[model samples]
Target: MTTDGCVFCRIAARELDASVVLESATVLAFLDADPVTPGHVLVVPRAHLPTLADLDEDIAAEMFLVARSVAGALRQSSLRCDGVNLFYADG
Candidate 1:
């Protein structure tokens, strides 16, 4: 079963827990509950929506923008990473 609420929704609400790395009015970045590596993170929107088709187009764009911003920051600040890879698991 999924959690008592939507996994993404609860994370958006801050009702559930995840190792969030970055957050904004439209997006949130957190670690994978099941992670492949130490640096893995998941970015999402604040709105409660099951899929990208369920969200507004602008919201989707904003989410992508936030994810890109995080990547840029990581490239600038992280000494170990040459570049960041963002993989959206749902896809």
Candidate 2:
């Protein structure tokens, strides 16, 4: 399910434009419009989960796995980053 006005949901649904980096059945990873770092990306589940507590076990695991993969790719790229940081924001 998705929330009516949730931005992430819009992106996931292809209703909004995003620099999509990776996409799976349950998750979407994309470049942040307002990134904290040069290669900053956001990983989110397709469902409208408002908080961590709202995520199911399988979806949560998939989210982390996708994030890890993205992080690795960023480190290997010419972004000049020694490491990657994953940030979670829920509200």
Candidate 3:
């Protein structure tokens, strides 16, 4: 979907409240309010791109870089983390 009025966009724009963990010029990472597990986060690009294929290379790279950093932080946290799983959902 387009970024206009999108919930993610709102979060990125700071119009919505989110427990943000990491943010860069191109990406935003925040805690999922209804997390399936503790520390669960949703990392997204500031620009609205419906699917991975739609994302420009640079933005996609930045998004994954942020995701990696988040996972690393999670692994280093006090939580009993066994491993990290990454999932991408587009709808």
Candidate 4:
């Protein structure tokens, strides 16, 4: 369910640019262009459904699988932190 002009779709086709981290037959992972933390990443499906209800169970499972892998890597990564701190600058 990719949009006619979506950034993720372009990233998938290589028509646009992105710093991909992980990729599988059905998924791709890239660093967050606007990150909330030092090493924030984005794990998205090759398709652009926009919502989980629009995706099949298999795709959802794979998405979570990628997230799990990312989490594992983060745990052992040099970017790992002992505690997570949250703050907001919005007013």
Candidate 5:
């Protein structure tokens, strides 16, 4: 499932080392390498897409759903957290 030039795809495929937090059919959530907060997770689609517009609707939806689940998990975890901020840019 790893794509040649996409780092996220490689991580999704487990070809790259990432502190994975959660994974589903179309999504992979992992700890950010350089995080601003303790439980900062990077939720990504398994598809090799550089931009949001390039992602399929189903995959995009799955990514957000995974993000929500990860956020809930983070909040429940020992990490001190009150809220979650999910951000993405089209380009």
Candidate 6:
């Protein structure tokens, strides 16, 4: 399910544009349009959930897995960062 006017839902639905880095059945990882760092990304469930409490455990796990993979790629890429940080935000 999805919420009307949800930016993430729009991104997941391909109604909006995002520099997607990773995508799976349950999650989508994309570059942050307004980023703290060059490689900053947002990992989100494809479903629209208002908060973390509303997220399914399986989907949450997948989100992290996707985040991990993205982080590793960022570290190994031309960005040449020694490490990566993952942040979770709910809106």
Model 1 pairs in collision? none
lDDT (CA) for every model shown? 0.74, 0.91, 0.90, 0.72, 0.84, 0.88
Error of 6 at 77 (Å): 0.4
What are the candidates' C-alpha RMSDs? 3.0, 1.2, 1.4, 5.2, 2.2, 1.4
Root-mean-square deviation of candidate 4: 5.2
TM-score, predicted candidate 1 vs. hidden true structure: 0.74
lDDT of 3 by residue, 1-91 (tens): 5577788989988999999999999999999989999989999988777678888999988989999999999999998889889999965
| Model 2, span 1-91: residue lDDT tens | 5498999999999999999999899999999999888999999999899899999999999999999899888988989897787778976
Error of 5 at 48 (Å): 0.3
| TM-scores of all predicted structures | 0.74, 0.94, 0.92, 0.80, 0.87, 0.92
Give per-residue CA lDDT, model 5, range 1-91, as digits (tens): 3367777877988888999988988788999889988998898877777787788889988988898899889889998888889888564
Q: Supply candidate 3's per-residue lDDT for 48.
A: 76
Model 1: residues >4 Å from true position, as ranges?
Answer: 1-4, 89-91
List candidate 6 segments past 4 Å from native: none
Residue 5 displacement in candidate 2 (angstroms): 1.2
lDDT leader: 2
Best by TM-score: 2
The superposed Cα distance between candidate 2 and the true structure at residue 71, in angstroms, equals 0.6
Model 4, 1-91: lDDT tens per residue?
A: 4378877788888888888878888888787788888667777778776665776898778877876777677778898556433221121
- Return whichever of 5 and 6 wins on TM-score: 6
Alpha-carbon deviation at 5 in model 6, angstroms = 1.2
Clashes of 3: 0
Q: Which runs of model 4 end up more than 4 angstroms from their true locations?
A: 83-91
Better of 4 and 6 by lDDT: 6
Kindly state the number of residue pairs that clash in model 2.
Answer: 0
